[model samples]
Target chain A: MSYTTDPARIERNWRAITIELDSPRPGRLERMLQRLGLPTDVSRLVVATPALRRSWFVALGLSMLIGLLATDAAKPRDDLFVLLLIAPLVPTLGVAMAYGSNADPAHEVGLATPMSGLRLVLTRAAAVLGFSAAFLALISLLAPSAPAMAFGWLIPSFGLCSATVAAMTFMAPRRAATVAGTLWVLGVLIARGAGDDPLAAFTVVGQVLMAVVAVVGLVVAVQRRDRFDLLAVR
Target chain B: MTNSEIDAVGQADQEDRALVARIARRDRSALEQLYRRHAHWMTPRLESRCGDPDLVDMAIQDTFVSVWKSAKKYRGDGAVGAWLWGIAIRRLIDQMRKKRPTSVDLQAVGGLEHAMAFEDTLIDNGTHGSLGVALRQLDPDLRAVLIATAIDGLTTKEAARLLGVPQGTVKTRLMRARQHLQETLA
Candidate 1:
């Protein structure tokens, strides 16, 4: 037990300690993304989406409060009305906060790679949409019309989210999302008021219109996707 | 420092500084040299604070890993051993934190209480010389506070944070520690 053992006698059993040499084990979401065939770096970037950010929790908590309160206090049909209205806003909020120099913390580093901008936006938007859809579907089950009603918001949510990403190529995410989200709410309200049915926006005719919006918005997003590669695409 | 720089001990410190610099560039061999040099001494020091060999083992692993990652942060002016010990102690504290969801009480035998036990080990190893014997006669609480300030070179605020006591409490205990040590040594 001599403290001053010669260097020749010192046991360098460091092979036992190289476990930390590898990068930190990927988180659950990041691992899942990797399994889905995303590269390690891209998967990591995707998992850092708003769902894990502190502000994302604020957005989610607001949506949860709306879903739970609307279920308890509002009438059954009116509950669906409130649920439909709030569901689309979650992904819209997430997509708004997903990319752009203003929304992203890595904007300076991101500017170094000119081509990754749209790929970053699309991958991050997909993660946001998946998370928002999963969360909203669970909340919708609490509605009086449990199963069939659960799928209703998916199309509208997809439409609004895509439209926000489209708008984001030209403006900042927050402003783009605000404009997209506001338009969806106003469009739904106008439809509800114009018809005999309070849930006019949830009808099949309205669903087809949303499908059109999804197609057109994604087309515009792809065509002008290059705009996202520029500086301050706000 | 210039006058002391000629000493044999200072030359060893200078060698350790070069090893740390090499480690910053991800040199595996330099890290091994550092581990061989310090791990033999640091293990018993850590085990004296945390008896669990597994916790000590993990803490040692974490310490060298940190030294590898944070080598660039080394100021070069301080002894590399001191820098490694700082990371080791904090890492031990962190490992202890994982085993207990509640805050770690430093005074507990498995936690900072073991830190107090090191004073005994210091005497057993005769590393602290005559000061260790004199300090043994002082109250454990005063001795613990004194060790945090004197040996660890922590400021009042930092000692309070490390010991999980209020700043005012650390201040009071430090004053009492000085008074008690003077009475004991006198």
Candidate 2:
């Protein structure tokens, strides 16, 4: 017939969400990673792989030369430069293909695991970046002149290419991403025809523009978080 | 600061950071180090929730798989412990949900509607120390949501995601659960 407002009574009656200050088990995460076929050594080898990393740097060098030729300051080969600028996109395209090939089971299995969506994105990106960086470094070494000669243009070119790739990736469907990427690369060729210095054109101003594209892409991806199926090839 | 205490703190910080970095790189050793660091706490917590040793073990296994795949995404934004908790909670929910028929809509709680009536009776009469007893009386669904959101301190949005419910549903269920708990205690 009586009511009690006692704080201790209320606390005692209310279930505390029991939390244990311990971990799951020894060797569990390692075994899980191993099951996913992503062992440390393999990851390291993937990062250190020459084929995966250098393609981007090679593309960067070639693009810069094409840019220089577009400026028509020295009449270096025009057709050759076009091919060079086009080369880097191949690896990313290959990535799309590889991702598409394993689209089903990988996504299902990955989703079944405890990994968050953000972690998945970061790991995939890091693997790609490591390979690309190594390749760039290698090209710089084999042709000392290339790194030294293109140092000024390298940053802008890389920034633009990366920004474009990142931006285009957010486009719905792989077809669109592919189309956008192709258009952007072709846009460089058009800029060449405008008789402007490609290197000069892709300066800080170009970087800022590319950065804007990248930021927009990031926002779009974040906003569409729920729709990003691991099974979707794009 | 005391020299010995400071050194211990420094060592712990280094070890934690190293473990996280290695996990990001998909290093099994790093993953093992992380598991050793957290398993003692996580296992018992999961075991308490499921009350089934085998289910708890499976949940733990699933949690680590998630961690390995997503390690690169850590970003060091939150405490590693908290991140681990987040993963474990989600994995546990997934396991629970999977037990239902494939035809069952994950968003719908229709199958467990009967459990709510039983859960309502779990209200205790303001006995402060009897909280665990009251919790044990709760339906599994209500118990899980309360433990995850109220006790674990996960945001409602996160709880909704883990439970595979819409945000509105999580709020409704959480409010109802709290009211039951308050009345039971009072």
DockQ of each: 0.15, 0.02
The C-alpha stretches of model 2 lying farther than 4 A from their native spots are A1-84, A87-91, A94-105, A140-173, A198-201, A230-234, B1-186
**lDDT tens digits, residue span A102-140, model 2:** 322355565656655434443554455444444444443
Encode model 1's per-residue lDDT on B1-186: one tens digit a residue: 246755877888889999998999999889989998898778766665555556767788888888888899998767899988888877776776566323445546343444435567665665565666777776776776787778767677766655667889989998987887677667
- Tell me the spans in candidate 1 whose CA falls farther than 4 Å from its real position: A1-22, A35-37, A70-74, B1-186
Model 2's alpha-carbon lDDT is: 0.53
Q: What is the lDDT of residue B13 in candidate 1?
A: 86
Predicted structure 1: lDDT: 0.76
Candidate 2 chain A weakest ten by summed lDDT: A12-21
TM-score of chain A, all candidates? 0.84, 0.53
lDDT for each of the candidates? Answer: 0.76, 0.53
Model 1: which docking level applies? incorrect
lDDT of 2 by residue, B1-186 (tens): 479987986677667778888877868778766776666556656544443444455567777666777787877776677778777866766676656213333236332332322223333433334775667656666776886687567788867765667878888878877777777767
- Counting clashing residue pairs in each candidate, in order, gives 0, 21
